[model samples]
Structure formats: structure tokens, C-alpha cells
Target: MAKIMDRLLLLVYSIIGFAVSVVALLLVSRIIPEREAEDWVESLYGTDRLLQGIVITVSVIILLISLRFLYVALRRGNASSPSIDQRTEFGDIRISVETVENLALKAAAKQRGVKDLRARIRIVESGLDIMLRTVVDGETSLPLVTEEIQRAVKEHVEEITGIPVSSVSVFVANIVQTQTFKSRVE
Candidate 1:
């Protein structure tokens, strides 16, 4: 997507350059005397054959260069693994807060002591902020589990989305206890 956007921007600049150059050339031509302009054109063209040849050569060169660049861009697009589209806006490129929250919750759930994880994300001026509530094993130390969950969530969200995580607040809302066969046997 980025490639197309870049190409469009380049095309705009080229058009602007061409317009400016033509305007400047026209202004310079106006400053010269009519007789001098005629003489200059006559000397440059001679029998008119050279002028035609120069025009053809320059046109062919420009066409070839443009085609070469187009070919390279197409080949690169084909070679890419992800196959993303060729144009994207700055707003479209940004990751949403909801996506970050989902990633954070999933990462927290992967921790050893966590039974379940839920997260909420907020977008602040500085960056994204996440609040997580986790269910953990009753036998696990609350502080240790909370710290691990917080770290895991923060790191995973940042890595996946490339968004800076300002704060991760963990709330240990519940403790899960698993029933053991030994208790039943006793």
C-alpha cells in the first residue's frame, strides 16, 4: 500500500516540476527579442530534421525510463509474501486500541498462574493504556502473578502493534482452585 502512495506523491512532484520549468522557460522566451528568438530556433533546428530527431530521442528515453520503473515496482509487488495493497492512508495505517486490548488479554492468559484474562484499552495523548483483570491459581502469590501478567501484556501488545504502552494495571479479581483426587480419596 505504501508503494502506491509513494508513487502518487512522486508523480505529483514531477508534474509540479514540469509546470514550473515550462513557465520559467516561457517567461525567459518573452524577455528575448522576436528576431533573436527566430534566429536561435533557425540555428538550433537547421533544416528541421535535427529538431524532429532530438524530440524523438528524448521522448523514447523518457518512455523507456518510466517503463523500467513500472516494471520494477510490479515485480516487487509480486515478490512480496504478504501481498498487501499498493495504497494506504496514514489513518488507515494506525492500529486501533481494541486490537491492542485483545492482544494484551491473550498474552496475559499465557502466563503460568493465570486462569483467565480480560483487558480494556484506552488511548491517551502519550500512548495506549491497558487495564487487565485476571483469574489466577489460588496457590500462586498475588504480587508475583500480577507483575508477570502486567509485564507479559505490555510487552506483547507493544511488540505486535508497534504502539507504545504507557501503563498496564492488573487487577487480580478471582482465585481459581482445582479439585484434587487426593481430597476425594481422603
Candidate 2:
């Protein structure tokens, strides 16, 4: 609910900024005469109860929105990346997705067949879902290589983080050439 409110407020703030910019541009470019702009401002102060109330209410809202922006800007820990937040009896622990990706890459790199690799980790309802995209040596069996990668990544990540791994999916993107050079006899 708080996030939704923040997003809505941000959208309103953006729109207000755009509208103000447009008006300022028009006024500066003489498209809207200086006298007309002055008249619009002076009209707000004229004897009108409902208009004044509305103006006051809008001003208060904008002030609150500005304060919220300031609060967010000044707050610490605002630069955090996406992570898995967990709580235990001792304290709360956060494992960043990038860390998990590195763990997966580490596990996959130990495999003999994997030449180049990439990993992605997703937090699922059950647990973590890992995806590995890899380039393998042409001599290795695709099924065996993929299976090894999936097993190694799942076990290593779970062992290190103590987080349950729901799935580890391996994608065999490409295979590298294995060429043997023959010796020339003169």
C-alpha cells in the first residue's frame, strides 16, 4: 500500500513538473503575455471562498509530497539492490541476487565441459529458481553437461546459503569447436 501511494505521488509530481515547465516556457517565450500571467496569479487572491479553499488544499498536498521526496532522498540504505530478505532467531539476513548468480557461476565453472556461462536467480514461492545459460565443449555430451551443471549449482547454492532451491534449469546455448592439428612430416 505504501509503495502504491509513493508511485501515485511520483506520477502526480511528474505531471505537475511537466505542466509547470510548459507554462514557464510559454510565459518566457511571450506566447502568454506577462499581463495575462499576472492576472491569473492575481485572480487567486480575489474574494472567492471555494477557490481559495481548493488552492490551500492543493498547496498543502504539494508540500506534503515535496517532504516525502526529501525524506526519501535523505534516508540512508536507499541504494540497496534486489535481494532475498530472510529472518531468523538471531537476526535478519539478506542475500543479493547478484551474489546468488555468482555462486551459480562458480559452481558451473568447476565443470569440465562448460566453456562460458551465465546465471540468473529468481525468488519463487517455493524457493530460489536458477537458470544457467552456457557454452560447452563439442566433445561433451549435452545431457550429461547440463545435468552436472544443474546438480552442482543447486547443491552449491543450497549448501552455502542454506536456502532451498526449487529448480535449476540449464540452457545449452552453444558448443565450442574442438579441433586437433596434425603434425606435418617432411
Candidate 3:
């Protein structure tokens, strides 16, 4: 809801900014006469005098607006990290999604026979659902490996975040054979 509101606000601002920019360009086009621009270039195109400083003042406002938007964009870009809010007795804590992902990956990796792991987190009504895609050794027991992965991921994520995990779904994507490089000397 808040994100939607923010996007709407940005839309409104962009519309207003586009309108203002158009007006500013139109004003600039009318302000400086091409024929006498060289003579009045030092005096704000001489329109500052004709308009009693309105030209210079408006131009300065536009410049400031452009700078302000640039600063806001930079700030927003830097704040793109995703966080989940947890309510505790003390207050609210924000946890980064990266931390949760790392925990899930680590849990899956701890299981023997797992060669590669991929984890994706989804929010459901219950809390979080962790979906894992795993690559394991060809000789591994599929049932045991998947069961272990599910249990491990669920336990670690719930214990760390204090958030109930609705489910841990494990998909065995591939069974890879171990390969060792051999060197031959002739």
C-alpha cells in the first residue's frame, strides 16, 4: 500500500515537473531575442530587466528543482536493499533478505550429497515459504536428501528469524556425478 502511494506521488511529481519544464523552455524561448542575444548575454538575456527579474528568478528555481530531483534519485538508488520487519517486545527489527537467503543456503549445504543449492523465499499468509532447487550426487538417496534439506532449511530460518516457516519445498533439479581431473605424463 505504501509503495503504491509512493509511486502515485512520484507520478504526480513527474507530471508537474514535465509541465514546469515545458513552461520554462517556452519562457526561455520567448525571453532571449536571437537578434540581440549577444548584447544582453551578460544581463540574463536582457529579459531579466524587462520582466523585473522574473526571468532570472524562475530559471534559478528550475535549476534548484533539477538538482533536488537528482539528489532524491541518488538517495533512492542507494536504498534499494530489501528488508523484512519483525516485531519484538523491545521494538521492531528489520532483517535483510540476504541474511535469510544465506541461512537457507548454508542449511542446505550442510547436508551431505547436496552439490548445489538455490533458495527462493516467498511470503504467504502463514509467514514465509522457502523454495529450494538442489543438485545432488547421483548416488544420493533422493527421498532422504530432500527430506533433510526441507527440515534443515525450515529449522534454521525459523530459529534465526523467529518467524514461522510455512513450508520448505525442495526440488531436486539434477543428480551430478563427481568428476576428478587426471593428469597423464608420457
Candidate 4:
């Protein structure tokens, strides 16, 4: 998803560059008289064919580079999740990020008053960062619930995976409403 967004942004920039280059060329041509502009261009490169070819070559190169970027972005990610590369005497060990997310979700769900849970794991300079967005019962204390969730997720994931957790960010997106007897009676 992020790769697509980044490619779209680059595509926009490339289009803008192309448009600006064309506009600038037109503006420069208009600034000089037709014959004088022609002479100036011919004088710069000696032959019009060589100048045009050079411009076309550069433009084609730019286009091809942009196409390459788009192609890579559209392609699927390498068939692997983020993990630490550890080489021991016997063999290599890898601990996937998917495992961390699943573990965090499980730990967060175990907390009191949690109604729904989502977790995302990111590789950071310090270590892994876990972000959890959750829905909970409205009657629950937001701070307490969030705190426990953060602690549980960080502790559990780090303990199981043997990877350090830099931080756990909990976002309480929504709170569910529970029915009361008085409201139903009224």
C-alpha cells in the first residue's frame, strides 16, 4: 500500500517535470524571433538533428527510468516478511514480523474491556515499534486500559520473539455502548 502511494507521488512529480520542461522550451522559443531562435538553436549544436536526438534520448531515458520505478512498485513484495538475520554455527534463524503482530493482538485481546484490536509492526532504528488501534467498552478507564495493553503487548512480543520493542502506541478509536435496563424500560 505504501509502495503504491509512493509510486503515485513520484509519477505526479515526473509528469510535472515533463510539463515544466515543455513549457520552458516553448517560452524560450517565443522570447526570441522565429529566425533568430532557429539560428541560436542551430549555432548551439551545429546540426538540428543532433540536438533533437540528444533531447529525445534524454527524455526517453527519463521516461524509461520512471517506468522502471512504476514496474517495481507494481510488483509484489519479496515473498518474505521483515525479520532479523542471525547466523549461528549450525544455521540461520529468522523471526518474522507477522508473528509479532499476531502475538501482540492476542495479548491485547486478553486485556479487560477490549472489544476489538488491530496491530501493526514497524522496524525502527532502536528496535521494533508496535502500534495498536482498539475499540473498547465505554465504561472502561481509557488510560488504564491503554496502559495495560501497551505493557502486555510490549512484554509478550519481546519475550516471545527475543526482539526489543522500542515502544507500544495504543490508539482508542471507538468505544462501544452497552444497554442499560432503565433505557429499555423507558
TM-score comparison, 1 vs 4, better candidate: 4
Candidate 2 lDDT (Cα, 0 to 1): 0.91
lDDT tens digits, residue span 35-130, model 1: 777875786678677776876776675576577567767774534222112225543454555667778988888888888878888777767778
Q: Which candidate has the highest lDDT of all?
A: 2
- How much lDDT does each candidate structure score? 0.74, 0.91, 0.80, 0.85
Show the lowest summed lDDT stretch of 10 residues, model 2. Answer: 72-81
Candidate 1 residue pairs in clash (backbone atoms < 3 Å):
1-85, 1-86, 1-87
By summed lDDT, the worst window of 10 consecutive residues in model 1 runs over 78-87
TM-scores for the candidates? 0.48, 0.74, 0.56, 0.65
- Mind giving the per-residue lDDT tens digits that candidate 3 earns over 39-110? 555566444576547766756766665666576667656374677787889999987777788899999999
TM-score of 2: 0.74
**Least accurate 10 contiguous residues by lDDT in model 4:** 177-186
Please give the ranking of all candidate structures by TM-score, highest first, separated by commas: 2, 4, 3, 1
The best candidate in terms of TM-score = 2
Candidate order by lDDT, decreasing, is 2, 4, 3, 1
